[model samples]
Target: MRRVTVQYFDGCPNWKVLDERLRDLAGEHDLAIDHRRVETPEEAERVGFRGSPTLLIDDVDPFATGDEPVGLACRVYLTDDGPQGSPTVEQLRAVLA
Candidate 1:
């Protein structure tokens, strides 16, 4: 089965948005999703977390461009509504599809 892992830190407001969308999509696809909290800089470095609410599909970050600085910060996605904390449902659908 494909694995979807969402990496986020505590108190990140945007994680919930992505989490809910992911859960809904996972249900539709019969996939599994995992939520991981990056609590420290060390863990972030070890896991190569680009930012809070980082989504990994089968251990690979599909949204990353290979230049994002790894840290415990809020990640932004460029959408039709301008920059947002989480990707749009359509965008997520394209990536997850």
Candidate 2:
């Protein structure tokens, strides 16, 4: 089974949406979803959390650009249309695939 972790801060509203989308994707892939809530900046730094709704596949953030500022804040994903709070389903599917 593939291990997936979604690290997020409580302040971000998009976390739940990301979680739900990931759950759907996991269901299709027969993967288990692990949700981790990072409540502090220290914890975020300890876990290398980039921002809210960070998806980690096998302990690696596949979508991370490595240049994102590490802190407690909302994350923006660049999509074909524009910047989105949460990545589109197609983006998620492509990453998971």
Candidate 3:
């Protein structure tokens, strides 16, 4: 099963959206979701956290552009639907698949 780590901070409501999408896609794909709540800037830097709702597939953020500022902040995804708080279910499904 693919291990997906959802790294987020409590301040951002966007993470919940990603969580829901992941839960929806879980059954369709062979994967497990691990939620990590980051509580500090030091911890964020330590773990390479780009922003809240960062989806780390096998310990890597496939959506990251490598230029996002670290710390507790809302991450926006540039989907075909345009920029959004979280990636669409279809986007998540493609990565999981």
Q: TM-scores of the models, in the given order?
A: 0.92, 0.93, 0.94
- Which wins on lDDT, candidate 2 or candidate 3? 3
What's the distance in Å from true for residue 5, model 3?
0.7
- Superposed on all Cα atoms, model 3 deviates from the true structure by an RMSD in Å of 0.9
lDDT of 3 by residue, 6-81 (tens): 9999999999999999998888887789999999999999988889899999888989888899887888999997
Error of 1 at 30 (Å): 1.8
Clashing pairs in 3: none
lDDT of each: 0.88, 0.86, 0.90
Residue 49 in candidate 3 has what lDDT? 88
Residue lDDT tens for model 1, 1-97? 6788889999688999999988778766666889999999999999899997899988999899988899889999889999989988888888877
lDDT of 2 by residue, 13-86 (tens): 88888888988887777778898999999988888888988888899888788889888988888989898888
- Order of models, best lDDT first: 3, 1, 2
Could you say which candidate leads in lDDT?
A: 3
Off by over 4 Å in 3: none
Number of the predicted model whose TM-score against the real structure is largest? 3
